[model samples]
Target: MSSAFRNRRIPTILVALAAISAFCVGCSDSEDESDSTTTTTTRSAEGADALTPFVGTVHFPPVPFAGSDGKNHLVYELSVTNFTSGKTTLDSLQVIDADSGAVIDDLDAAEAHQRLQPAGSRDSADSLEAGESGTIFLHVTLDESVAVPKNVVHKVTTTAEAAPPDLRTSTAEVGPTKIDSRTLPVLSSPLRGERFIAADGCCDASRHTRAILPVNGQTFVAQRYAIDYEQADDQLRIFTGEPTDPKSYFIFGEDVLAAADGTVVGTRNDLPEQVPGTFPSGISLDAADGNYVVLDIGNGFFINYAHMQPGSVRVKLGDKVSTGDVLGLVGNTGNSVAPHLHFHVMDGPSPLASQGLPYLNDKFSITGQVASTADFDRSEGTGIPLVTVPGLQTTEHSDQLVMDQNIVTFG
Candidate 1:
C-alpha cells in the first residue's frame, strides 16, 4: 500500500473501542501433558500458514466490519497462555500515526466494540492454555489490498497470565450535570475527536443525538446500560496501537473515582467476578449487573453507577459526596471489565424503574464536531484534539436546562 493511503485509512480502525476493563474469561488450572514441542501453523489473510507464537494464537472466527473511512475491517478473538509460569511481560504492541507516529484509539467509528472479540467462540478454540489454560480479547483490522508482511507482529505479549483482582467492596458514584444551564455538559470522550451522548450503551451513531439532554431540564436523558463481559470475568482489556502502543493493554481492579456527589440510595456489592466471554459458561446463574449503585442527586433524579469493584465502595447507601470524591476504584464485580465504572443517569430510584434523561456536566469540553444526520462530512479529526467546538455554555444568571433544539442557537 502507498504510504499516503495506509496513513489515512487504517488509524481510524484503531481508536474505535469504548471500554475494555479486565477479567478472567478462560482461566483454568488444568494439567497439560503435550510435550510434542512441535510447531502448529495457522492461516493468515494471504492463505499462507505459519507456525504459531504462543502469545498470538487465535481460534475465534474473524469479525467483518466497515470502517468510518469506508474500508472493510476484521476483528478477531483468541486465547493466550503463559507457559513459562510466574509472569510474562507484553510490550511493543502499538498502532502508530503514519506520519507523526502518534497513537490514538479508533473510537470515532460508531460501530466499534468497547473491546475486540466476538460474542461467542467454538469450544473456546481461540483461548490460550497455561500448561492447560489462559485467555485474552483481540481486535484486528485487515486490508487485503495492503501487502501482507511475512513477519508482521499482529499481536504481542510479555507475561504468562495476568490475574484479576479481588474487589470485594468497591463502588463508584457518578455526579450530576447542570440541567438548568445553557451549556451542554461533557458526557463522554471515548477517545480524542470522539464524544457523544451516554444514552445508548451501544456504539451506534444513529442512536446519538443532541436531544439526549432535555430542553426543560426537568429530567435527564434516558441511558442504556449493558454488562461489560471482560470486567465481569477478570480479563484485561487492551486497545490496539491507537494513541498508545499495544503494550498499554491492562488488567482490572484499577481505581474508578466518583463522577459526581450525592447520597447513596442503593448499593449491590456481593457478586464475584467472572471469567471473560460473551456467554460466560455460568453467566445465567448471576444477575446481569453483579454489583451496582444509585445515588440520590436530590429531587427525583438519581445517578446510576454499575459494575463496581466488590467491597471497595467507601460509602454506605446513605453516604454523601462531592465532585471528584473517591467513592471506589474500578472492578469486575458486575457486568464489567476487570475494573471500570459503568455509569448513566436515570429518573427513578432503580435502573429498572427509572427513565434515562439528558444531562450536562458542571465542567468539561467537547473535543469533536457535534455530528448531525444531515451531513456525514461533519466528522473530522478523529485523533486530533478539538477545542472550542461551539455548542453550549453555562453561567450564573442564565440557569435553564438546555435542550436539543438549542443546538442551533449555540452552533
Candidate 2:
C-alpha cells in the first residue's frame, strides 16, 4: 500500500453541483444523455479531475529465478506516460511488497534517469511533456531462501506547477505463470574444442540485451537472458594480426548447431555481413537481428540463434531439427559489432517480439573469465598480458545458469 493519501472525501455540495452540471450538459439537445451520464460517472468514480499526473503499466516474468549469484532475481519494467496537460516531474518510483507493505526498492530521480530508455534519455527538459512516455528498468535480487512474492506494488510520485503533488500507485499479481523449466539441450560447442568467452550471459547488470524494446506499438520485454559468445584464444585475444578482416577472428564461419530437438519456425539468411571493426550505419529493424533462426522447442518455448552467415542456413521453415544438428555457420550480420553468436530463449516465434525466459545448461567446463570488456579489448588490440583466473577446474554445471564473462567449453 502507498503511504500517500489517495482517497479524498468528496464534498456533498460539489457532488450535487457536478450532477446538476452533467444534467445541463445532457439536455443540450445535440448530445446524448446516456453519453453525458456515463462520462460523468466514469470521471467521478476514477476521480479523473484530480488527476494522478501519470499512468502506465508494468510487466515481469511470473516465475522468478535464483540466478548464478544464488539470489532470487526479479526483472521488470514500468512504461510510464505523463497524462497531465502540462509538464510534470516524476520525482520517484518504488517497488513495494504488497503483502507486508514493505519498501523493496526505491528509485530516486537520478537513478530513474539512468534507467530510462534511449528515447527518454534524449529529452533535455527536466519534466515530461504531456503524453511523453518512458520506460524504467527495475531489477530486484532477494535471498534465495526467501519465498518469491505473489504480488507486487508500484508506487510513484509526480508534481505539476499548480496542482498538489500526486502519489499514484498500482498493484500487479505475480506467480509461476512463466514457462516451466526444462532440461536444456546439452548444446555442443558451435566451435568444437575451442574456448569461447561469454560476453553477456544470463542475468548480468551490464547486459543491454535485457533491456525492454518498445516495438510495433507493443511493449516487448524480450532477450532478458540472452548470451553473446565470442571466441578468445588462450591469451584472451579476440582478434589477431589484421583487426579489420572478419577472417582474422576465430569465430567467423564456425558451425552453428541446434541446441535442442525442435522445428524451425523462422530464419533469415540473405543479409550481408558487416565489416569486422565498424557497425553498419542506419541499420533497419528487420536487418538488425542479422541472419537468424527461431526453433520451436515445444511447450511454448522458442530458441533463437542469430548472426549466422549468409547462404549458410541448412534448415528451412517447418523443418524438424534434432539436437546438435548443423543449422548454419556463424557470421557477423544484423546489429552485430563483430562475429559472434547471439542466443536466447523466448515464448514466441517472432524473435524480437516475445518474452525472454531463463534457461539452464546440463553441463560445461569453466576455464577462465575476462574481468571486463576494456581488459578484453586491450588484450586483443595491444597484446598486453591479460590476467586470467583459474575457474572451477573442469567442473560440470548441472542445470545451472551461465554467468557473464565465463570462458567455458562444452562436453
Q: Which regions of candidate 2 deviate over 4 angstroms? A: 1-51, 59-63, 118-127, 159-162, 165-194, 202-207, 373-396
TM-score of each: 0.34, 0.74
Give the per-residue Cα lDDT of candidate 1 at 382.
22
**Residue 182 CA displacement from its true place in model 2, Å:** 10
Best by lDDT: 2
lDDT of 2 by residue, 347-393 (tens): 88987789887666656667776777666656545445445664545
Q: Give one digit per residue, the lDDT tens place, for model 1 in 214-321.
A: 234322223422212111111111222231221222324544445455788887777665443222345432354567767776655667666665686677778887
User: Model 1: residues >4 Å from true position, as ranges?
Assistant: 1-222, 225-251, 279-286, 337-339, 365-411
State the C-alpha lDDT per candidate: 0.34, 0.65
